[model samples]
Target: MLEPQDHRLRQREYLLQISRAITAQLDLASLLNLVITYAVEMLAGTSGLIAIYDEEGDDLLRIRASSQLPRDIWPAFAPLLALPLADLPRQGVAVLRDVATDTGLNLRQMIALPLALRQSAVGVIYVFRAALNVDFSANDRQLLQDFANQAAIAVSNARLYQGVLREKQRLDAMIEQSADGALIIDSRWRITTFNKMMEQLTGWTRDEAIGRPCAEVLGIHSDQGVNICLTDCPLQRRPPAENPVAEGRITSRDGREIYI
Candidate 1:
């Protein structure tokens, strides 16, 4: 029998394993596989599963990975694990000592830990044992719960980073497709990004336009005939959402007038 101190040490080791596994990859599939494998090995569970909640349409728990469970069981098990966020416990762990003992239920010796973020349950980490020898103790349940909390934060961050990348790609495509010149200016009025039309119209390449002041690059002049770069520009007067577009005349490097 493992002593209380031994259990604590084992739990610490398991937590470290989980932390290392999560940090090892930004890819969701690799992260899910790591979580399931680590949970089964460290928690002494015969099987492990990770189910991620869909953000759109439904609150279903889509199984990301599993070990040692029948493929058919997933269809039935998904609904049982897909309880609403409000119904789950805020903190602490839950343990079902022997699933086999509960004749009506098809599962045995399991624990469910909510992968929570900002007091919401985003997913579930389930660990199960088919035989009595590898049954989860109260301490094991607590350790697994703590691991789940950390995993949730890691998963959330990964998802957010992925979303940012996708949004960037979409914005880039939109800029390329635009008929008019689309330029992104920084707080200092420097051109951060400009569409292909802007480059072609101004006789400037993307490489030359980036990081240069708009007035210096586009040659916009004020009503007083002063360089706009020397004056407070109107483009910076409003927030991005409020002022996405501006119209002005610019002189090309070749001395041709162009409307932007």
Candidate 2:
């Protein structure tokens, strides 16, 4: 058995380690698993679970992560999961809740904490003890609350990052497979994305075109023989809602003037 002081120090170390691991992990599944696993181990509980509210506003709480709870025992936990959101503790504190004993499960005590960010309850974390008299102390509740706060922040960030990544991938696919030549420029007027069709049109590969000035690559000239990119660049004056099409002559890499 660990000395009381030694156990406290070890709990602190586990919190530090969990904080580091959760923040660095962007994958939601892996982060949730890491959270429940460490939470169960740190609290010395027989089992634990993290239940997250559906983002689609279905008013449903689904088990996103669990540790050591047998597959058969999951149904016994259903009543707890189905508890109304209003019934769960949400004041940034963990509290003891009575677990049903008639379900043939040996669970006796549970410490429940809301995984909240700002004023919204995103989820709940529950740790269970099987011992008859092993009621969770105030210190255990506080420790779990602290850990749940960190886990909430990590979960929220991971969801946001995943949304951004998926959108980026979709936009990239559209740009790469576009029939018309397309390129994206940054605020500094430098090429940031040179799509495949642009390569066929300009005779310059993506690696060679990226970071170069858009005016230098396209070399577009107006009907009046003026270099429009240097004089009347539409990108500078166009309204955000407007998608105007202007025909211009471009000097290709092979010294051929191509009308586009």
Candidate 3:
């Protein structure tokens, strides 16, 4: 049995280890695996599961990670995790020993912890003790709770990253399909993106036109043959051309000059 001082030291070290592991990688699968693996090893348990609540609750809680749990039987327990268990009891913990005799879960012991982020519960960690006559102490619960909070942060970060990627993809698709010769530039006039229409009109692939200046790509001229790129840059005038339209000459890749 670990003395009070020894338990405190061990808990402190374990918490630090967990923090390092979770922050080392932001991938959701990798984070979940680290969490479950550490929990089972530290608690001296045989198996474990990390279940994350579905954001919309439209889908059941997802088994983000697991160990030694029968893969085929995991779905049978989904109903149990549909509702998240937020806070521990007043003792700051609970224990269900020999629960298999009553509930037939086949688990020798079960300890549930709330994966909390700030004031909200995001998920739960379940560690199973089999063939070990040990019970989790209050210190153990506190340590595990801290571990679960790290899992929650990893989950939230990965979810936010995924949302940002989706938005970028959607915006790119709209820009590519736009009917006009669409190109985006910063305040400095260097092209940021050149769309499908822009590529076709210029005879330059999107890859080739990006980063080139407007004057370099489209050298405009007035009907009087005034070199607009040098002398009559409408974009530089006080009241920039009422309509951002002007006749310009574009040099294609094959050395053909086309007027627009």
lDDT of 3 by residue, 162-190 (tens): 89989878878899989987777768777
Pairs clashing in candidate 1?
A: 99-108, 99-109
Quote each prediction's TM-score.
Answer: 0.63, 0.70, 0.68
Candidate 1 lDDT, 1-260, residue by residue in tens: 45768867866776776677667755776666666766776677778788878877377788877767655656656434655434534311232322233323334556677798999877888887667555577867777777678768777878788889899889888997899877777888788888998887887888899999877887666444566545546665545346544345677777777755
The lDDT for every candidate, in the order shown, is: 0.70, 0.78, 0.72
RMSD of each: 6.5, 5.8, 5.8
Better of 1 and 3 by lDDT: 3
The best-first sequence of candidates by TM-score reads 2, 3, 1
Q: Write the per-residue lDDT of candidate 2 for residues 1-260, one digit (tens) a residue.
A: 56789888877787777777775675676677777787777778888888888988887788887888655656656668877646755521222233345345556667788899988889989887778676788878887887788779877887788889899788878999999999989999999888998888888899999999999999789877888888878777656427745569987787777799
By lDDT, the candidates rank as 2, 3, 1
Tell me which of candidates 2 and 3 scores higher on TM-score. Answer: 2
Model 3 segments more than 4 A misplaced: 1-26, 83-106, 184-193, 207-250, 254-260
- Give the poorly placed runs of model 1, Cα more than 4 Å off: 1-25, 67-108, 162-179, 185-192, 205-260
Work out how many backbone clashes candidate 2 has: 0
